[model samples]
Target chain A: MSTSSDVDLDEVYSFALDLAKQAGKMLDDAWRARCDGGPQTGHVEKESAVDLVTQTDEDVEAFIKQEIASKFPIHKFIGEETYSKGSSKEYLIGKEPTWCIDPLDGTVNYIHIFPMFCVSIGFILDGEPAIGVIHAPFLNQTFSACRGKGAWLNGTQRLPLIRNPIPPMPQDAPKGCVFSCEWGKDRRDQPDGNLHRKVESFFNMAAEIGGRQGKGGMVHGVRSLGSATLDLAYCAMGAFDIWWEGGCWEWDVAAGICLLKEAGGLVTTANPPTDPSTARIEDTKLGGRLYLAIRPAGDTEQETGRQGQERTVREVWRRVRHLDYPRPGA
Target chain B: MSTSSDVDLDEVYSFALDLAKQAGKMLDDAWRARCDGGPQTGHVEKESAVDLVTQTDEDVEAFIKQEIASKFPIHKFIGEETYSKGSSKEYLIGKEPTWCIDPLDGTVNYIHIFPMFCVSIGFILDGEPAIGVIHAPFLNQTFSACRGKGAWLNGTQRLPLIRNPIPPMPQDAPKGCVFSCEWGKDRRDQPDGNLHRKVESFFNMAAEIGGRQGKGGMVHGVRSLGSATLDLAYCAMGAFDIWWEGGCWEWDVAAGICLLKEAGGLVTTANPPTDPSTARIEDTKLGGRLYLAIRPAGDTEQETGRQGQERTVREVWRRVRHLDYPRPGA
Candidate 1:
């Protein structure tokens, strides 16, 4: 197992950035072709009818895999397409250099031409996310970050794009905060199912501040853009104050987590911490299927950045129902 | 009172387009200033706590009104900011040529820097929408149209951006259809309230096709971008197959409806037509509080574009709960 010190972070980040852009170009070409009267790109169901996969998704994954192999032949890889097809259903993230990729993160958006899909590539060292890159061809934006360094957009702008001092989380938070969440492919509506819980939680979050029998959150706004990667990326950019989701794989969030942390944000499990006093952002597991992300905080006389983020997380956790999503090999 | 023929639509459209772009620039400047450490632009509640209005919105609206009045002094005007403050609560759509404008649509998105807000301008002649222009500053894209002419994006690409022959609505749709809807500011969750109905309808639309006790529409995707104007414009662009909503004013849909019609799309009430057999897209009321916009359809030997649209609408209507929203003067 190689330590983080053994890797040249600059070279890896540069390579990942170039690879993400190349992959984005391929996605753009296929999208343009479809829009320009090319044969319709048919899709097939993956886990369910709502979960979809397309030829372009597979092709992009294969292309990315080949390029990485030629450039870093010794590095291991865990890609969405390959994992879905592999006979072994377990994910192995050992303490070694590995690339975790979601070649096409928003497949449904891609098929519908909604212009929110993207390519996400995350590099893990010592079983922790070290470098990340994501490119959205339609939006013409690229976000990248390396551990201990800063996050960036289009390789220029330091993120949270708002360079100004951010205001501390509102006293009545989850209120006056722009929250982002997704309706995952899990549509089972049983009383205890994730879908039912998600719907109830969403309703509660958007309800009047004192409505819903005192359970209302009255969030400033709620957005579901159908792309988890972009959702996390936007959270990192300070466009969203909070993002919560479940039923997503490690590849879905590995890159986004790195970007958010580099931007001075925090990531924790979607569920409330079992030991509130000891809860730490560093304790967040990469393969944890449920995740909650909070934007960086503003320093003030009464509270520091970490204190504000922790308070906001606790407030948000109380408003949401506990969601359950089995970890790989659990 | 000028008839459609009595007005010069080409000249009016040109003026509206230029005005929208100029308004977009102002919005862009203010946004950049706010991001670059300018004093925070404070907001106040208008109709409710969820409904907000900032100084920038008022300034932009005033600027647009002045530009239009100077260019066409004889024309009437109905701007959102002015209407919200006026003594007369009734909306009067006389036969005179008029401009209906929403200076800053998606105020929440703009405040959050979510990049989906826009300035919308619609020209009404003969009591009908004749010219439309919408400019999204952050997105750097503009949509425009003139009656009897074609709709366009950025003055070059034809509307729909998809030149290929679009496929007809699927046999079981809202299934396999990309649907767009919004959770409006009305967050009341009473048993029979619009908010409750909307939540129920959204669940039904996203639930599994065979689940939900056969009530599921199982849409291919559901998007809530927090912008009514853009939702309708995307419908015109053939990206969103269906967009249903209530609680939006005429200024919100007038420009979008014009763009949709010019792109061969259709607009009808969100409620099921009183007499399905007699439901005609041309009969859709501009001031109707509820709306459902459908994208243009492809030609086929068996079904024409209109037929395809009607079929899809009926399918969608049955799957959603009936929602009630009062008209402006009701």
Candidate 2:
């Protein structure tokens, strides 16, 4: 809980990392406890039919908030569960030093013990993410970053930011680039939803990636990590070329945003960018729009410029064509 | 290594588990060694535009085969890489013991380090999975089973055999009931590619699970855990229901098939059953049909099944109308 007045940014980052480690330990303990045949006390409700919410989720969120508040009373906080109940009031740009948290990001995976879940904590100062700490306790891995400092894995290893140049579009999607997506909360209601369309776009893009040489997409494959925080962290680590999500709150992405930015990756709209610098993180949400997070594909690759990752992503977005398709040619 | 004359399944089970552990370690070392900073050093090429192959993938498969041959000379082997070169030469049923291995199931996820990858090994005696082992080395989890004996996690904790029954079909697919599938290799090149149709059907089923109550599809959610072996293990553990896959060889599922059956789960073809006894696992692949590994759901709220599990799973499966789409949509 180091504040601007009490400590430098580095000190604050170190403190955040410490808190994340502590939180990570709690999650690990909880996971083990549950695994050891603990009580089936949690409720089974689908946030989206695919997304699960249980008491453990609430418990984890409360634990993170309590620990953070007790240690650093002055820092502002916005957490997922709380935000769902009106804590989102302060997430605006130019806010006080705030820590946005998704205590257990992949709740659905955790409930099933899928092991792709994580604890994410992000620090925002003056409307921009300054430092972020994400821990996948189950995997025993941590990713952290500060604005001026480069991103690091497990504290000692410095990670380089890398993305391949958007190779020529194939007649199909590359079979390798795995796109990560969420099923969201209201898929059944929509049937032919923008999300479904988005999924189709992903398939279409993947098709293009694997399509014949003349008709392909840029990425090789797609994946849905089940957690936004982990998805961003994966993108930051160059494990994925693009991560797009809609209907997510700041807490779900706050920590990942910092890690992604620090990794020299860009998180922008899936739609064409009208303005670049003036674009704020909040802009990531306009139009229920998706955020395209691309790793920094180097100089020769950068020659593709704005049309680079941004263009490839936007092209996929536009190529989606329809959010809802007629049910099986009916 | 165990033949019927003098073979103790337990001993072979123990040996295979040991081998799994050793192989897992090798995989861990390789994974870490490859963690050096760089955009992944491989291109995803789809032969026939449906099958995907990468250099590191071939190397990993080769490394695994070499290690196994060096350690156990008599055990017959079948692997994804090997089968890629030629169709499986079925082992004599009830004859000598043989092994099936997916050196890396979920290779796409492995390439991305999405953490759902695993080294899978299934031992067959008399044409049945006698004992099976699946290890996600990076995740530090190994699921193993010996026929007539319950499955164990990391060799200590016994997994619950009863699963939550497949709930009624959701209007949208739920998130918790993960369905693991792979895009067929040479998808477009294949005949009548109903691949997209299958994907669309999956989307419908999965989306229903995540849809609103009375609206969303069955259970809580859907997931593609990347690795077929692990996905089946999860199903056996009741972590998910209805894990289906197409275009995968016995190597990708042999170990998991045993685990699922032992855990009280059921496996069937998505198509109509013609001959249940001679279901040669591949019959589940009705002209590129899908494999369904379904767990019985119970009336109890706990993971433990009470009454509804079996009937519910059967009913739900029956409800999912078979898609008539061709394998490689024409």
Candidate 3:
């Protein structure tokens, strides 16, 4: 190993890749088996439907947990199914090199058979996200990244989309932009409801001419694939110019963050859209309870300095300033 | 030809299926050619940024028009690209057979290389949507239906989703709903800006407990695939519980309506929320400048009669009551 804090990075990455495929097969089989049973067959077992979790989610998570423990032995694990039951949040930061697993990132999409969901796994080294592997079995696409070595799609193409730099920006005219957000898991209708605020802001960003408050951002469009993992992975490739959301966890974004960062994309709170470089890796875990991510500019847009990525992030963020939400449960 | 209708139903259905694939291939090829070329490559020629049209759209439309003219000879055609330039709208409601082609639906999604776009072709006989075919090459799916023959997917499975009927409703509270909507092409920020009204209403359907006038439907989730063709096709299969949209034309919803009807789904004006059975097929074109579609209730879940589908439709519509938009220039 390179240092005492290090594990064999490539070896762990390979293990993650294999584990993800194994889990994907299980999930897909469950999906196909229930396909003809109608939309409700697979969606029955749930924690208040909207924030759905099925038998398959737990089955897949348990499988991955068993496999990871058998293989890694010493690594700490923080998985979505077990996140609430254990002290995994304590394992999020530290030199223990935790592994974050989201067995199924888009459960809602899966239930509806909308064909956009994936399995995401991230390896954190000494508290810094270092390796990420995301696999969408239905779409037959996989995205993975190693900290310094670069990101890859399906084992070949580089990330930040097409492994190419973003296209050159047209002068003056705000570069045509696309932003994505989610309805999220919290369905509270209270005055402090998060969705109410999100819906208002989504309208503000997507409306034409001038949006709410006479300032529509006029983005090309907005999308919600119902999966944070795929969203972050697509954002890494620049497919989605920007993906900002709240109420998702590290498991949802950890793997994607590796691919995103390794591809030279930037991430910050969905609100207060700040310079991503300003935060330390460990200390940067959703201090604002939201995340705003942008693909680096290249001709596929070029990345100049903090200004390069920040300019687009700041520009888009200006229109969505209305999305700011109060701290959860506060 | 059957009866005095003088139309060969199967022959026209075959013609539509062939033309859809031909157009789908051309669209797919153009999509691949422009994949790595940033967002603007395929979107070079456009009416506006958000409401985009590429060279492929025109080329594909022209190709379909020529092929239909040469083979069908006497058939009238209404293709989106040529709609504004000619008197095609006059041919929309006629005893003569007319082919409505959306050369490229979800143009925005296609431009972004997002994989959610397709070619939709529908044949209307005596003003009744008879033959329908929608091909999405990237997804390797083709949905088609004939008035009495029923709908099919990939040329094998019956439409209305799988070969199976709509699932029976669960005994529990509600078999969580999954609804779909569109950002649409209209960008006017005015009160007539259907999008402004849509945004406010979408929030209402999606919010929970009490939202926007203390009435939230709390649908299982919401989706915006940005493709009306695919949205309707999926609704026919019961994939999306409900899809509400406006400002879209006949070509957009025509083909899908055929499949939905064959699948036993329901379609009505989005604003007034009328009974599909009471409306004439020709008069049923989202004349209110809107459409509300629902998947047929299957034995899998029995919510009962018009009330079954209407309950969900009315529930969601209550939140969007303010979304009334004027016809075009009004």
The better candidate by DockQ, 2 or 3, is: 3
Candidate 2 C-alpha lDDT tens digits along B56-168: 55666676677667766676776667666664333323456676777777666666566677878887877777788999887788898899997777887666422223233
DockQ leader: 1
TM-score of 2: 0.81
| DockQ of prediction 1 | 0.68
Please state the CAPRI-style docking class of candidate 3. acceptable
Model 2 iRMS (Å) reads 5.2
Candidate 1 per-residue C-alpha lDDT over B261-330 given as tens digits, one digit per residue, 9 for 90 to 100: 9998888888876655456655468887788888877877888878888888877776777778776465
Which of the CAPRI classes, incorrect, acceptable, medium or high, describes model 1? medium
Residue-wise C-alpha lDDT for candidate 3, range A1-330, written one tens digit per residue? 223255888798889888888888887887666656534435453445487777788889999999998987778888888875563344344566788889988887777666688898988886668999999887778889987988887887666544343543323212366677888766666674577667766776776655456657677778877788888887776667778788777788888888888887888777643443343322236324578787655542343534555666555556664454454333
RMSD of each: 2.0, 6.3, 4.1
Chain A agreement with the truth for model 3, given as TM-score: 0.85
Show the colliding residue pairs in model 1.
none
Q: What lDDT is obtained when candidate 3 is compared to the true structure?
A: 0.72
What does fnat come to for each candidate? 0.60, 0.25, 0.50
Task: Give the winner by lDDT.
Answer: 1
